[model samples]
Target chain A: MKKSSKKTGIALLLILAGVGVLILKGVSDTGVYYRTVSEVLIDSSLLEERGVRISGEVEGGTITYDQQELKLIFVVRDLEEVEKTMKVVYIGIKPDAFDADV
Target chain B: MVTLGNLSQSAAFMCSLLAMVLLLTGLMRNDLRFIEAGRRALTGVAVFASMAAFSLARLFMTDNFQVEYVASYSDRALPIFYKATSFWAGQKGSLLFWAWVLSIHVAMVAFNTRKETTRKNTPYIYLVLAAIVSFFFLLLITVSSPFEPLAYVPKDGNGLNPMLQNPGMIFHPPTLFLGYIGFTIPFAYAIASLISGKVDPDWLKKTRRWNILSWIFLTIGIILGGQWAYVELGWGGFWAWDPVENASFIPWLISTAFIHTSIIQERRNIMKVWNMSLIVLTFLTCIFGTYLVRSGILQSVHDFGATGLGGYFLVFMIVTAVGSIILIAESYGDLRTAHSLESLVSRESTFLFNNVILLAIAFSTFFGTIFPLISEVITGNKLTVGEPFFNMVNTPLFLLLLAITGLCPLISWRKASINNLKQNFMYPFGLASAGGGVMFGFGIREFYPLMAFTLSLFVSATIVLEFIGGARARKKLTGEPILLAFPKVIWKLRRRYGGYIVHFGVVLVVVGITGSTAFKLEKETTLQRGEVMNIGDYTLQYKDFNSFQDRNRTVYAATIGVVKDGKAMGDMFTERRYYINAKQPTTEVSVRMSLKEDLYLTMPMIGKNDEITIKAAVNPLLVWGWIGGTFMVVGGIMAIIPSRRRRLAV
Candidate 1:
């Protein structure tokens, strides 16, 4: 083999090996899909406790807050081909401009 | 006031653009007359922009409600100080402010450096600055004009946002702007050098201290922003991976890398390409950061409005990016390192690694900050990439960087002997390992903190060893006490040793972050008129509440007795206030800060009949972060100051 090729051959091999190790170390979360509130409401039990952020436009006039418990309940609408709405319960006090149309 | 403001700012904008065209045409045609004309036109631009700023400030001070920007951001009720800060409180005025700064910096650069450099080089530098000023001035004229008037002038105007009515806000934007504007000087100089083919050490030496000044201001700006967030937002965390925060941070990172690696280029005639790339990247990132803040591609705490300037910023970015790419490609031959690597185990290699890691961190942060935009383009989904993602990715990277910092100082330049390496690092490594062991033994399960603390100990030990070694060497030669020898050694090598002290400050900051984030204790309490809550040997007794209305705002205050070790330490008051004209609520946090920890109390909200709810936390070593930040700023100043002995002797 040529000098540079011989020197780089081991380095390339070590890099590939390291990649293989990292591949094994990382779990495949690719199949675990992310769904919006309306999409998940169709099969809520399937995503009961899995990690996801159900994002949609916060529906106007559907936000209610309990100052005592600091719980906020709001309806989020998915404005896809078919308009669908889902209820979201948040525990913390809402930020300013939270009630505005998203 | 409004009409005059419009006239002056528009005049400035047109003048700057006219000057930029003149400079560009002059450089292209090699006409001295056009260059002189360009300089005079730019002077007009500077004068007009300053006059515009002065007009706006005058209107704000006098509470001139006829002006729309003044009406939107300032009021008769606001104090003189807050009224002054109204200059940057809105989009139109902030753009005007930005234009003002750019013009002044450009004017300063033109005056100072025009005579020193060649005529050809001087024109190019002037053109670069004028081009930048033209873009911003045009932005001011077209998209977000501060001089636009309201249809109907009301009796009262909306006041400043209560959250922004802090001491930090007054200084933060200017410092950050100084940093952002300061980068343009070196960038313009570099482009000027490339065009003139006077790409030598002369320009580099001329711009080095400017680089340091920009980096230092940017550093302090970021820390002040964090302090603002911690105090104003009451988020219980200092940095939240916010887009605006990331925008400032990226340039700071690149500037830091530039400052360090430029030393290599200066002394050893190496890393020339790297240093040049860093300067370009720093300036480009400054523009990119301005776009991120002003474009509204991402939502942030710092957004004024998304406005009509997104397309302008995007087009400017593309043009600048393409231009810089072409320039860098053409200048590749001039930037190749003049020397070869002598060894892998050397200061050179360490700097290479440091640059790589710093750039990697910068890339990761940039990716995270703009990930939402990219993801939306690719997948048609807007996903929030929050603190968790950044913390996860950056924690290990920072730990590795800390390891590099710990080891880099010990290694010699060009080449290092294995024996010398071991002799330098063995004790520090052993001490850090033992420290790690003790922390692990004490049930520290978090991998990140344990690693951070371990690496911090290693870095601290290395700094200590360097100081001791230098002091001892000085004492041996001069036959003086250690204290006397220390100052003598520092005087001789202020830049190098001062940098090491700054790195020591960074170590302390990292340690403080690790301690505060991992070991803080928090609790939420709802109390009646008279009640007490005990947490971690401190008792917080809820006392009476008070309500007061001022000209600026109405304050709903929470009185509490802070008792530690069965004795009353002091009484603290936290408030949730309503600024009347703005109609916004702001939280005022009360913090009892010390060397060890901070007793932080935030009044999240209040109810009718004086029922107060507070979120209180005992955050460990939170104060040290501020202390370390102060040290970083102080060390930077020390590096800039000429040595007292040298000055005296001279």
Candidate 2:
């Protein structure tokens, strides 16, 4: 019984370890750095080829949308440093909440 | 004059606090009088909480612009049902609603006239439940009261969010609250059993129906939320892996694990420690989920944004987490089981494995939900993990869970002999391979999806085979007809059969998700007059776009003449409504739903050249998700009904 218990413990450990590895790999594969537009502007290429989620205020009058092509081009200004900006070209239906003036 | 809402809210708070003290005193001093007083105090708490809730509802119904919450979420122009629905429209009102629900559940427990068990441990139940109730009321009476009066009355109010004006919104939050708050009952019972040192299966057996009931409510809540997102939110897909969705889903997953492991405890009298932690964790995660949704820390389109009460919730979460941990630690020695697993290949071990997978998935989702915060703390940079991370980690784990779901019931109780394994394995294996072969023949090339479909088939076959096998055995024994024997067998083991039905429902949902996600076809284009959009064997010709005023809003809508299978299907209308009292417009998507596929249409924009841009998707087998949810609810309800043996024994 004791030996069987040990095996059960080891089996459980192995499963946890396997799942731990999967979580690590998944995080590494899909983790995107959430950054401000200022940070992205300061060092876009310095970062690795991973995705970056930039949080900023949209610059008014710099937004353009192609209804047919579903292309959106807008300049996102930094919340902290308003002068620092990044032009974002996104391809999707514009969300209902997204607006130029925050 | 003080409002009745405020007065009763305070009275409820006082009664709950008094109940907790009296119950604790009774527990310490062995005084039935104090315990009985504590129970009565809890009944008072329930009464006052209900009165508080009703008062708030009355305030909304009467369009009482003097109350801040009622004024904020209701208006004169809103309909009567929505005015009542405004009772839980915001944080403050929902807190009262939640408190009222918890109070009712507590009162039911206290009012139960079970003599022996009642005398022994119900004081702890009263203490624990009243403690939670008092905490909610403390927040209500002090920080975020729904009855907080405005300095001056207004003639009219700022209306409810146009997005929340849907019928789905009316039912979704309250149903979810019922589900979330329902966990508190079993949680309190578990704590009572622990503190009273009666860590028998009595608590488990008693709370079994409560667990199943709460699970059904939660299942319905989640399904309604998904349906709301699909139809109302104009997001063609149901689940988006948003933090708000994940928050609710995480608890559901944990509670599901808890519910399953509890069956083990009820039978084998083991996994008691695990069950205690799971129920405690379930309660804590419910609180955390509430915090996630109401705290406005996470970004969701649901828009129950940032509030001052979030800090209090965080403190409450920490307190409960620490307190439950301490209680579990205190009872650890009592909770240890005599029976250890004799073999890893037993039904017992499948539940353990199932738990491992479930917790892994839960942990992964929780981690993904809070990853940005963790990243910001560790690396000084916020890192976001989206659907890809969740899908990558969870898909394989879910498939493993699906496989275990198929194999768990068929395995022997303790350990399976090779012959028993062979008997169970042969048919499911052959059927699954045949199903996989058919799918491959039908050009299912993707590895994960093919595997998913095959495993879905395998799981389904096992569930069906269990029924057939049981019915056949019963028929052979009694010489009864197959149809009569089939239902009788199922009725005899209703709990297991109900579980099997739920599993079958889950299999259907998996097939639906796999089909919809893997084989979904979508089209986006600008269509002028008579321009046809070809998407997934259906063509939609652009008819006309019109702008008009409805009763309360300006409706900009487009009509599309749909054609499917060379037959002229009726025109589909997708509209955007601009409400008078709201800055934003709501999207109403058009869907032609079927068992096989759904043809969905949404128009987000129209061009100046009289052109309309339509987004359309052929979502395959998506309806089964809702169908499966209904089956799960029915099976869950079926499982909870008292069996004849138990009824006769009682």
Candidate 3:
């Protein structure tokens, strides 16, 4: 490569490297792993990971909302296996689409 | 009526297909007659497409329950405007709408390319447009036909989704579609340049207004969607980093990168290959974005159900990408840059860096959007990436982009000496430092927001300095009153100055985003009648809740009094509406917006005895986003206006 072209290449590589590092660091730092209730039921250690979003069917009649202090507790069962259930404790009000019958 | 619509659509499809064939054959045989016929066929396609579109809209207006699409998205009770917009609400209707808009664009291109200068390239350009229009019609007529008839006609159709009953539904979809379809014109021009081996800055200059026009539409559409979400969706926050949001945003990012780099190509006759790739990628990503929204491959709050259209969309995207890549490769020799970056301090380098940053952000967002699929394929687990991942990744990069927006104009072209850099950046840098110091004194010392605000002010400062410098120069040269020369200076150099205005507007938007996200406060409580709740120094007293019938729905509105610092700040109302045909109620959030903050309230739920739960929030500096959006649209208009060539005496 010509000297000038090589210099340009180095500059390009440096910027790309800097951006690559930023993206990788963010992925490791804030990327949330997701799990289904069945998987979590099999290995509870999944929840021990830094951040995990669990997918499940909210068991009917297991939702309780304390409107006074805005605490919510609910039981969600696996989509496929009803026996695999996880109780969740949340400290926020329900969003607009939080249907009680879900 | 359904038969007419179906026949018109079929005819439109045949016209586009015939246009493609004739245009290709005309090129091979060198027959102007055949190409002229092809161009006329394009006009025919537009006519038939419009007829079909009108037919479907007529079905909705007449409440024709015999049509499946109309039956699904409209009801007898919906208003006329909403019933009209229902033409593009569902998958079938949306595909038809895409074809309709695209056919109009094709017709515009065919009729407008009559000049001797443009005649040589019209055949290839028309062929590309015809091919694209044919693809949409292929999807529409075969898989997702709006003209499909129902087996049984019900008494009354299902109403439009209550969530879609807002004014946004009327405006957002069509505007976004215009943007999504507008990129095809530029893409077609690029393809024409490749096939004809006439790759130069000519196509770039010809399509500048088209690019800016489409970009403005996309910007407005996004801003309107955010407004809709904040007020109607009751999310309290404007953006959620959802898959559908990422779909539209990725193309915007790529197109933004193209808009910046194409200038370098135009002025310096370089980066031709990069500009080509960016435009082609932009158009393909528009298709990809539409696919993500329509295919339902990923779970999103949008809830566009999993259709069988994913494979077809995947095929289209791959086919276009491969075809464009082959053509670009064929013209690789012509696409070479005449010059390379002369120095790191050059404007060209800044454009390159800006492109890199933009593409990086787009790639990461695209990766995050399809992470579930990637994870499932790799690990047998559908791991969903969410808001935190996006925020962590994009925030710093966006801050970097903000910094570049300030730095790009400050640097001279090709190369700049240290003295020039010092002269240009000194004021912006000092202003940013002062901005940081002021915010720190106001106890606004949080890391991310502080950095964002400082960078935003820096960018704003550069733009302001450019304006002042230009106006002063004009004043000294003309020996006119400074006031008269200011506007004249802007008019003379409208394109550059207007771009600076847009940069200033972006700074406002960033400031708004940072302040609102960082300093947001929320409180929720169950309020009995005549009870009061306090959040963020504002006391909201619930006056009463009442229900009334409004047109097609029952509206439940809560009148609440707001008091701030011992002063009555008027009243705000939260509404919960139960559309008769909808399965659930929808919330109408009430917000009292000011320059400083937004006082937002939502009635999420009502229990027995009319005890209501109110979600209250104070989002600081939220109005700046909308105002900045206005400036962007206005500045974009100014930039796109054909600059008057009034010769400058200076």
Best by DockQ: 2
DockQ of candidate 3? Answer: 0.54
For residues A6-72, write the lDDT of model 2, one tens digit per residue: 8889988998998899889998999998788877777778356588777899999999998767899
Candidate 2, residues B1-650: lDDT per residue as tens digits?
A: 23788899999999988888887887788888888888889999999989988898888888989888888998998888888888888888888899999999888887773354244667777788888999999999898898988999988888888778889988889888899999999998899888888888888888898888898888889989999889988878889889988888888999999989998988888898999999999999999988887788888766479987789899999988898899889989999999877788899999999998999999999999898889888988788899999999999999999999999977998888999999989999899999999999999989989998999889888888899999999999999999999999998888989998899888888888888899999878878877898998898998888899775678988889999989998999999888888887778899999999999999876678667778899999888888888888888888988875434444
Instruction: Give the residue spans of candidate 1 off by over 4 A.
Output: A1-50, A55-70, A77-84, A93-102, B21-44, B117-120, B476-480, B642-650
> Taking the tens digit of each residue's C-alpha lDDT, what string does model 1 give over B1-650?
77677898889978877887887778778888788788778778889999999989999988888778888888788889988988998878888888898888777776776554346578778777788888887888777888777888978788888888999879988899889889998998888777777667566777887888888899889999899889878867899888889999999988988888888888888776677778989999998888877778788889865887878988987887788778777887886655655666778777866776677678777877876676678777554466766676667668878898999999999788989998998999999999999999999878888999999999999998998899999999999999999988987877778788788889888978998999999987767778888777689988989889977788888899999998889899998888886545888889888888889998786766777677889888888888888878877876776655445444
- Positional deviation of B146 in candidate 2, in angstroms? 0.9
**Model 3, which residues run further than 4 Å from truth?**
A1-5, A69-73, A100-102, B116-118, B644-650
- Each model's total of backbone clashes: 0, 0, 0
Q: Arrange candidates, best TM-score first.
A: 2, 3, 1
User: Residue B473 in model 3: shift from native, Å?
Assistant: 2.2
Ranking by DockQ: 2, 3, 1
| Docking category of candidate 1 | incorrect
What's the TM for model 2? Answer: 0.97
